[model samples]
Target: MTRKSTGIPGLDSMLQNGFAFPSAILVAGEPGTGKTTLAVQSLFHGAREGEKGLYITAISEPQWLVQKFLSSFSFYDQQLVEKGMVNFIDLGPSIAKNPSDMLEIIKKKIEQYQPERIAIDPITPMTDLLQWRGETREFMHELFAFLKAFNSLVIITAEMSYDDIAHSQESYMVDGVIVLSYPEEEKVRRKFLEVLKMRGTKHTTGRQLIDITDEGLAVQAGLR
Candidate 1:
């Protein structure tokens, strides 16, 4: 099987040269846990390698606002976007009445761009929108199947509260699950990364400290 490195330094080593290509990974984390940064960085890393990358966002945040937030990171590459190597699609304002519309839109984008790597930043909104509607499971199944068929290394981010990580179904369905968390220890907030489950691969089993600076997220070597 072909493998695509996450390009997140220590993280790839943990996954034994990074996630398997054409697989779906779920990045679950609480607010301010650097989920967006990790996802965007992966996209940019692939883009720099001359691979087509796509970022699909469901949050209502404007394109400029999203760009502004990512601009703070040194890994944020503007040239890729300008050159059409990297693309962003916003699904926020369009489908307020139906969440299933998100599936169709995403499918269209994948078909059009055929990106080698894709990131769906914070899929929390879509999950919330599907709650009680009995469509989330179907949506996930279809989406995952579609991405696998599209042959893209896909990352889906989910906003999780302290307890949501244990209760969410998204974590169970993905090929791999990466959890970012900030636990209060000794009166200090410590950020860590846990590779919960990765199919067909031997990965780091324990939680490791993660640092998110201007260069983006990197797992502490000492923790390995």
Candidate 2:
């Protein structure tokens, strides 16, 4: 299996080098947990490697606004976007009334650009839009199957409120799962990253401290 670096330092080492190519990973976290930063950094990392990258966002935030926010990070490279190596697609309004439309849009984009890495920032809105467990499950099944066929490394971010991480179905469907969290420790709120699962790869089993800086998200060796 080919390994694709996650672009976050110290994290690749935890996955024994990096994530396997054609793998689907779930990055679940609560608000302010750096989920968006992690996804953008991963996409930028692939762009820097000369591999095409696609970012599909479900929120109403304009593409330019999202780019502007991420530009503060050192990993955010405008050159890659200008060169068409990194492409951003806003699917907020289109999928607001019909979540299944995401599948078609995703398929078309994947077929068109054939990106090596793809990130769906915060898939929670899609799930909420569907509002049916069966529909959400079916959509995920189809989406994951389609992604597997494309031989692309994909990251799907999902918003998790307090105590919701253990019950998220998205965690069960993906090949790998990484959870970013902020838990109270010694009267202080501390950030951490935990690898719940990584199919076909040996990875660290415990939580590690995560740091979000202007450069992006980085994992420390010790858990907070």
For each of the candidates, give the backbone clash count.
Answer: 0, 0
TM-score of each: 0.95, 0.94
**Superposed Cα deviation of residue 114, candidate 2 (Å):** 1.0
Off by over 4 Å in 2: 132-134, 221-224
lDDT (C-alpha) at residue 19 in model 1: 87
Q: Tell me the tens digit of each residue's lDDT in model 1 across 1-224.
A: 78988979799999989989889999988889989999999999999888899999888888999899898898888888999888998988875677878889889988998899999988889877887798888988888778777888989999886477666778777899899999899999989999989999999898899998889999988667
Per residue, candidate 2 scores C-alpha lDDT tens digits across 1-224 of 88989999889989989999989999998888999999989999999888899998889888788889999899988889989899998888888766768788878978998899999998998878776645887788888889988889999999986468667778778999999889998999989888989999999877798888887899975442
Model 2 compared with the native: what TM-score? 0.94
Off by over 4 Å in 1: 161-163
